[model samples]
Target: MTPVILTVFALTYLGMILGGLPFLKLDRTGVALLGAIALVATEAVSEQAALAAIHAPTLILLFSFMVVSAQLRLGGFYDWAARRLGALPVRPLVLLGALIAVAASLSAVFSNDIVCLAMAPVLADLCIARRLDPVPFLLALACAANLGSAATLIGNPQNMLIGETLHLSFPGYLAQAALPVVLGLLVTWGLIGLLTWGRWELPAGVPAPSVHSDERGPNTAGHPEPGRPLNRWQSAKGLVVAALLFAAFLFVPWPRDLMALAGAGLLLTSRRLHSRRMLGLVDWELLVLFMGLFIINGALQQTGLPAQAVAGLAAAGVDLQAPAPLFAASFLLSNLVSNVPAVMLLLPLASAHPQGATLLALSSTLAGNLFIVGSIANIIVVQAAERRGIRISWRRHARVGVPVTVATLGIAAVSLWLGVGAP
Candidate 1:
């Protein structure tokens, strides 16, 4: 049973690192699902145990927020925001700053991936229309979303998990994280601006209208075209609900999952937006991925191998309970296995330390900017841009992502050192 559990754990994470098993149609989500299924089928863990392993608060909170994000997307608020921001008559640098501000703020409350998904296409169109290069703006969108999401626990999925599992004070974590996130966003804008100072215009040879698509709407040559116009009533309703939920998370003693679920239920009951449409926008694949990883990770913990491994590492002077090693490990493993899974693997060690939750949230979220695969928000932005014939290659992304990551991580390390004292 030990060997079987170890093998399943190894294979599941290997799938995460490789993005999937070779010669199989399985993606990371599929691989994770299979590992959980194998555990139950072999009776290594009972069905009841497997079911109990899942953390319902995290999943419920995530699902509720997804519903809230879907409401905003369906209401066209994201698209409208992008267009409105881009339409400003400011200089290129001013426009860039505005885009980052809006992207980061929205992502802090809403899911970063969904924000990127809804905004990418509209931003591409805006850039093309303004005759400004779309690449820098797109990179800023992805990078800012990842950075801003670090400000609060609800900003991204991994943060949400850490917050729920550890029961960290939402306001306390925000104070710890606020400086790093804000500084990071500023550094991102500066780097992108420096790299793209004179190169802000679109290449002379590319056709302008090629950037338009039916999903967003048509565009004439070099003219601002509308995509999804603002649904004022629906947008207002979603904003009010989101504002109330944010208040509940901050001050109220109500369970976050219940508060979020209640907010989602209110949004779902809208007569204007169909339930099917709202539900369709939900990322069910991501939910399944979380469930699968929870079971696989839970099963592995039962075998006590993780405990032994940690003891072994500590014996060798590689103490994960200390903040520094945990921070480094979080950053590296986050880029390797992706943030959510990496957080699950490290959460136990982190939860035991004084400021581990802050370390986990900051390191994992910031690491996403290292590469395209490091975060779902990055992938969402890249894919959305690709569909519009605006290519953001790996080399192109790394040019900005690498520096931004280094600078932000440096800020985080210094802040954490001062706040928690050295380990």
Candidate 2:
């Protein structure tokens, strides 16, 4: 049973890294779902255990926020934001700064991937219309979203998981993360501005790429209709709800999940927007992916192999419970398997150390900018750009991503070590 469980775990993670098994139609989500099914069929994990393994708080919180994000999207808040940012009568570098600031601030409270998804297409079109190269702005959108999300536990999925499981002080974590995140965002802006210096437009006589839009792909961005005006009332409603939720998460003793769920319910009971439309905007695939990974990871933990591996590593002086080792490992594994799975794998180790949660959150989130596939936020921005015939190749992305990642991680490590005195 142990070997069988290990096999299932290995295969599932392999799928996660490869985005699916070769010669099969499975994507990461599909592969994850199938892995859970295999474990159940083999009886390595009982139904009762499986049910218990699912973390209700995390899922509820995640689902509730998706509804909230959907409301903002449908309300035209994100579109309005992009237009307003692009319309500023400022130089390209200043406009780039504004883009980074807006993206990072929004992502601190909302879903980073959704923020990128909503902003990318509109930004691409805006750049094309203005005769400005959209590549740097698009990259800034992805990079800032990932960086800003590190500011708070609720900023990204992995951060939420860490916060909920560890029961770390929300305000405390914010204090620890705020410095690194702010610095990181600035670093991202500087790198992009420097790299694209004086090359902010396409060559003469070359027309801007035609922007594509359809309802086919996941949350596709179709061509914008003329004068499809902003719904101020709806936008205000979402903003107020989101602001209140942020306050509650920081100050109130109430469970964050319940507060978020209440917020979602308020938005759902709207008089104009249909519940179906709002729900349709939800990323159901992401929800399924989380649940599947939870089940598979839970089953593997039951087999005790993880504990054995930890002991073996500790024997070689690679103790994960220490902040320095965990910090380095989190950065590496996050770039390797992406952040969520990396966090899940190292979470148990972080649980025993005082600074483990802080180290995990900062390192994992910041490390995502190291490569395009290091975070879902990056993937969302890249895919959204590609849809509009604006290509951001891996080489192009790494030029900005690599230096920004290294600088931010160093800043975070030093800040954490100085503040927490972790070795």
Candidate 3:
């Protein structure tokens, strides 16, 4: 019974790596849920133990941050940034650098997917207005976001998972991730610049609406809502709350999730903006996805498989404490199961080695540059591209992705070696 239960568990997760089970209509989440049911049905784990394995702190932390991000979004924060960026007057290269920088910075704080989701169409429209091929610019958006989000624990779901599970210091993780993230963004821009060099033909004319599809009905800048015309009072309130939150992250001696949640709550107590409106902007699907993956990963842990896998790798001359296998494994596994799941799988093993968690976070994130499907930010750009009649196929994406991955990973490996400590 143990063998059969374990076999089913392995097969199910392997299917997760492929994004689905063979001959089964199941996505990664569905595959995970199925595995859990099988484990329960076969009595491999008791109901109580199964529940215990699933980490609730991580889930609560994830959901709370989503609320904070949601508050900003409903306030038209991202759309405002997009329009501001789009409205800028600068040379193409300057504009490109700014776009990458903005994407990275915003993604480093909020969910990268939401950052791209709100920004991609606006950027697409920006490209059309400039008569540039939307392909490379949108592609840059995805890669930049993935790279940027890797910079902070709050940036992407995976980083949060790694931080919570490993109990990494919020500021400490940032120290490990900051350099690679900054460098990665630069490399992303360079790669995009070269790839789109000849590709930028000015669109027919300087005319078209903005590309922000899911934005609020009226552009806050364009149409004043009778009285809510970008009040300094409200904006100041939000900024004050956010700034204090950042300071807390660096200096406050508390769990990051709780601090962030309190900040969100502070922002929620608005004089004008209703809580319901803010709540609507939250990415519930993503929060749900995190919860589901947590339970599923918990089930896998119950089987004692990760321990054995770690042992096997250790005995086989795989010193994860060393940079080589650690780097390679982080990169490969990130692409294998997507970065979030990959982080969950590896966070446990990361405990066995020095600086393991830091390397895991950096490598998993840089690995996102390997493929279009490698990160949620990538898909946002891809979907937005499809809407604009521009397609960035696997090959087209790989042209930049392959080189970007190699170059950035090389830089990350060296950086990790230096500041991440000795083996």
Candidate 4:
């Protein structure tokens, strides 16, 4: 049974690294789900244990926010926001700054992946319309979304996991994360601006990419119609609910998951937006992925191999309990297998350190800017641009990603070392 669980876990994570199995249609989500099923079927983990392994609070909170983000999309807020930013009558560099600001702010409240998914295509269209190259702005959108999501526990799935699992206070984590996240966003803006100087316009003899309305993909329920008026009322409703939720998380002593669930309930009661429509936009696959990974990780933990491995590393002078080793591990593993899985593997060690949650959340997220595969936000932005006939090769992404990651990680390391946000 140990070997079975180990084999299943190893294969599942390998799928995560490769993005799928060889010659199979199973993606990371599919692979995770399959691994959990195998464990249960082989009696390595009982059905009850598998069910118990899923973190209900994290799933509830994640699902609730998806509904909230859905409401905003349905209200045309994202489209309106993108258009407003693109239409700003300022120098291209200044416009890039505005984009970084907006993307970061929205991502801090909404999930980073949701912000990118909702905004990227619209941004690509607007940039083509304005005859400005969309590459830098798209990169900024991805980088800012990743950086900004680190500012709060609820900003992204991995941060939410870290906060909830470690029982870190919302405001406490915010205090620790705000400085590096803010500084990282600014650094991202400066790097992009410097790299794109004098090359902000579309290349000579290259026609603007065509925009097809239907290419927005399956999650298009709330996408804005070209001539449709912004639904200010619906947008306001979503915003108010989000604001109240944020306040509750900050001030109220109630469970954050319940408060968020209540917020989702409020948004679901909208008269104009059908419940089906709102629910349709929720990332059910992500929820399933979380559940699957939780079960797989839980089964692995039961074998005690991870504990032995950590102890072995500690014996070798590579102590993950220390800030420096943990920070380095988080950054490396995040890029290797992506952030969520990396965080899952490292979370058990978080309790050993004073600022483990903050360190994990910040380092894993900031490391995502190192490559396109490093974060879902980056992938969303790139795929969106590709659909519009704009190609952003890995080399092009590396030009910005490599420097932004190095600078932001440096800031985070220094801040953590100086006890800037230490509790």
lDDT of 3 by residue, 193-302 (tens): 87777657754543444333343355436752111123445555655676777788888889877777787788878778788887787766566556556656676676
Error of 3 at 344 (Å): 1.4
Show where candidate 4 strays beyond 4 Å: 214-229
- TM-score for every candidate vs. truth? 0.96, 0.95, 0.88, 0.96
Tell me the tens digit of each residue's lDDT in model 1 across 1-423: 888888999999999999999999999999999999999999988999999999999999999999999888878899889988989999999999999999999999997898998898888877888998888999999999999999998999999999999988878888899888888888899999998889998987655544444455434465446566678888888899999999888899878988999999999997789999999988898899999999999989998889999999999999998999999999999999999999999999997777888998999999999999999988988887777677889999999999999999999988998893223
- In the range 1-423, model 4's lDDT, one tens digit per residue, is 999999999999999999989999999999999999999999999999999999999999999999999999988788789878988999999999999999999999999999999889888888877899999999999999999999999999999998878788999898988999899888899999999999999876555656565433333486543322358999999999999999989999899999999999988977789999999999999998999999999999999999999999999999998888999999999999899999999999888988887899999999999999999999999998887788899999999999999999999988988989666
Q: What lDDT tens digits, residue by residue, belong to model 2 across residues 51-97?
A: 88888888888988899888888888888898899889999999999
Q: What shift in Å separates residue 387 of candidate 1 from its native position after superposition?
A: 1.7
Error of 2 at 342 (Å): 0.8
Q: RMSD in angstroms, all models?
A: 2.4, 3.4, 3.5, 3.0
The global C-alpha lDDT for each of the candidates, from Candidate 1 onward, is: 0.90, 0.86, 0.74, 0.91
Clash totals for all models, in order? 0, 0, 3, 0
Q: How much lDDT does candidate 1 score?
A: 0.90
Name the lDDT value of residue 362 in candidate 2.
89
* Model 2 clashing-pair count: 0
Identify the leading candidate in terms of lDDT: 4
Model 1 earns a TM-score of: 0.96
Q: Considering lDDT, where higher is better, how would the candidates rank from best to worst?
A: 4, 1, 2, 3
